[model samples]
Target: MKAPPHFIRNNEEWIIWLLEAEFSGSATPHALSSRTGISLDTIHDNFLYMERVGLLSIERDPDKRYPEEIARVNLTENSLRVYDELKIRPDPGDLF
Candidate 1:
């Protein structure tokens, strides 16, 4: 399986994508930020970029009650292919 684009295959974004995939599209930007030590704004910005690149889908809450209740992020079909590739042969540094 071929890898994703360089930007999506990088550590930070890749980890976020992995986590979101693992959560079955229920992963929020705040959760990603907390887990990855990335700022909420940075996570949100990356989500938007990933969506634009066809790598992710971010569904904003229609209610939009709170700032933190933005939406859930999930990997797209194309992104899932990359996820499978990563699973088959993960980076050495990713082995924890």
Candidate 2:
């Protein structure tokens, strides 16, 4: 599905869309960064912002490395609602 024209167009939209469409609502920040070509730090920053806004829930694992400490990231109901509304899906040909 394509994002509606009125949908908030930003990196975070792509992040949440990826989570909903491909990852079953949960994935590592590192994997997301790899998939989206967004930096790990940027993904972490977005996660924090999304969490604060009640869009995402982040789980940290100290057993992992620095950024990987953010072991898992999941979309919240609010985010899922947005995804359902926007229906944004990146073209598979556009991804690595």
Model 2 misplaced stretches (Cα beyond 4 Å): 1-8, 63-66, 88-96
Residue-by-residue lDDT tens digits, candidate 1, 1-96: 124334364644565455645566458777666766767777776777777888887778887754455588777787777666655675556666
What lDDT tens digits, residue by residue, belong to model 2 across residues 8-95?
4787888887898888999998788888888888878899899999999989887886666888999999999988876755544545
Best by lDDT: 2
In Å, residue 31's CA in model 2 sits off its true spot by 1.0
* C-alpha lDDT (0 to 100) for residue 71 of candidate 1: 81
What C-alpha lDDT, on a 0 to 100 scale, does residue 76 get in candidate 2? 92
Q: What is the C-alpha lDDT of each candidate?
A: 0.65, 0.81
lDDT: worst 10-residue window of model 2: 1-10
Candidate 1, run of 10 with poorest lDDT:
1-10
* TM-score between model 1 and native: 0.65
